[model samples]
Target: MSERTRYEANVCVLLHRAGRWLLAVRSPGVAYAPGQVGLIGGHVEPVVGPDVFETTARREVAEETGLDLAGVDLHYLSSELYLGDAGQPVLTVTYMGELADGIEPRVAAPDELSAVGWWSLAELSTVENCAPWVPPLIADAERLLRRR
Candidate 1:
């Protein structure tokens, strides 16, 4: 057999409540993009039962921020392929979710994130160290949200 490449599959979640984005600021200790404002998500776990992307989005949100997304509606925004720090091919899928009326987000994983809060795009623009890809994701999410 010929050689084949292996890629890591990851999922990212963007949550919005009344046109405000639920954003996370990564801690300075992370291996990738530390101290940046980015979406909340992680690698997809190997599970048999639920949708892997959705499951990962939910799990990551719960782990990174003390927020349960069980009741929120999740919409797939986009998928991207990029090179990781280790020169591995990485496939990242992004999901957009709308936060429930009364639900709130908190920084649950101190080691992974420094802060978690809701902000408007205008407000988010002023945040330092925001990820470069974050604006594109937000645009995609807003476009999708308008279709709903």
Candidate 2:
């Protein structure tokens, strides 16, 4: 049998005022379960002379959450590995960005996003069944908070 290729992607976890971080609830009807909160990001598309983070950050943010990155400061958060079916590995490059002008997350794609909102890092930590990928992301957020 031949080996399968692993996918690499970059993610941006948008944080808003009052220490609230953005989350997208995965829609239930899809292959993955619905109502699962996750950071906003997608694959890092190839572009001329573009770094992994720069190329995907703005586009991924627009795709996942309908918020624009105008004047927002994007900070490198952390990177972690996520598993796919058959134990395949996917690397997620995560970041934290503050809202520039008090805009909120809207449903850019209703089918893919059942709901979107901001929650405190503490609240997110307390979520009973947050996705397996969240703890590391939260740790990254805490680190960012400390530096502030």
After superposition, candidate 1 runs with Cα above 4 Å error: none
- Model 1's alpha-carbon lDDT is 0.87
Candidate 1 lDDT, 32-66, residue by residue in tens: 78899998999987778858888888999999998
Best by lDDT: 1
Model 1: lowest-lDDT 10 consecutive positions: 119-128
Candidate 2 residue-wise lDDT, 1-148, digit = tens: 9977867555555565666777778777767656778777667765657466755877777776777775777777777777766686777777776675457778797778888887776787777657866766766677767788
Candidate 2 residue pairs that clash: 28-34
True lDDT of residue 54, candidate 1:
89
As a TM-score, model 1 comes out at 0.93
lDDT for residue 31 in candidate 1, whole number 0-100? 85
Task: Give TM per candidate.
Answer: 0.93, 0.80
